[model samples]
Target: MEEKMIVLVAFDGSKAANEALSLAVKHAEAFKGKVVLVRSLKGGADIDSEDIQTAEQDLAYAEQFCRERSVPFETHLLVRGCSPGEDIVRFAEECRADEIIMGVRRRSRVSKMVFGSNARHVILEAHCPVVTVK
Candidate 1:
């Protein structure tokens, strides 16, 4: 039998992220693969205890979503002092994921210039194929 493909999905509780998560779950069910939900905390932010608690809540939601769908899912919370995009790429590499599903925000040129796009960076840097949900 062929090796089941491993899929890594980045979930940030955004609408696009939720869509990507749904798509990843559907694809995993169809392909008989495993799904890894990765949530990364960016550096330099003074995160309070409440913030961590909120993150845990989000992770729980992701887990529940997978359980409801009966899809194999794992949750990974990465606390590296690095950009979220870079961390996601590294995690994908470490997991040997066949594909990555992430969300992309529609941004104007001015916004893109002022705030760099994480989705863009991930698309450029990731070794595995990326599916971005807008």
Candidate 2:
């Protein structure tokens, strides 16, 4: 049997992220594969109970969306002390992901430089194809 296509999606409880998830589902369905939703957080003092709770809620929302579509899915919350991009790339490498999907916002170069765009990092660093949703 052919190896199942693994579509890795970066989820962050945002509208753009939801759009990315929708695109991911379409890709997974086309390939007869599964969707892996990932959310990353810089742990320790960077995260709090409310943040964790919000993340879980986000994952749950995505899970329900996948289930309703009858799409095979799994979710991951990475609490590693790293940027979301790094966490996502590492997880993709570990899972042998076929593609990585993420949401991006329109921002000035200065804004990106100040905030450090995760989509930009993932696009540059991921071993597989990277898809961006705005």
Candidate 3:
């Protein structure tokens, strides 16, 4: 029997994230694997009703996306006092994921030099293989 793969998809409600979601669904379907969609809320972000509602919407959209594709998946929202990249890596470890899929915004040299990339951080820290979608 083939090994059952656990895929962790990191979402931030960006177009790149949506692309990662799409790829994750395809991969999961092909491998007959299970997908865990995670949305992280960084610390210091406001937690008003509107913000909570927006987070719910993001998870809903991800769930809908997988449903439309007939992908077997689960959804989770991680709201801890950590950076997005850190949260993703930690969650993947906790879930014992075989792979992680996340969106990456291509940054210019100046931007990358000034501000570190979340995708880079996760890639460096994750124990599992990471797939970054632009």
Estimate the TM-score of every prediction: 0.93, 0.96, 0.90
lDDT against the true structure, per candidate, is 0.89, 0.94, 0.88
Q: Single out the weakest 10-residue window by summed lDDT for candidate 3.
A: 43-52
Full candidate order by lDDT, most accurate first: 2, 1, 3
Which has the greatest lDDT? 2
Tens digits of per-residue lDDT, candidate 3, 67-88, equal 8888888988888978888999
Q: Write the per-residue lDDT of candidate 2 for residues 1-134, one digit (tens) a residue.
A: 78989999999989899999999999999999999999999897757989899999999999999999999999999998998889999999999999999898899999988989888889999999999998
> Superposing all C-alpha atoms, what RMSD in Å does each candidate have to the true structure?
1.5, 0.9, 1.9
**Candidate 2 ranges beyond 4 A from true positions:** none
Clashing pairs in 1: none
Return the TM-score for candidate 1, rounded to 2 decimals.
0.93
- Ten-residue stretch with the least lDDT total in model 1: 43-52
Q: Cα deviation of 91 in candidate 2 (Å)?
A: 0.6
Pick by lDDT: 2 or 3, better one: 2
Q: Whole-model lDDT for model 2 versus the true structure?
A: 0.94
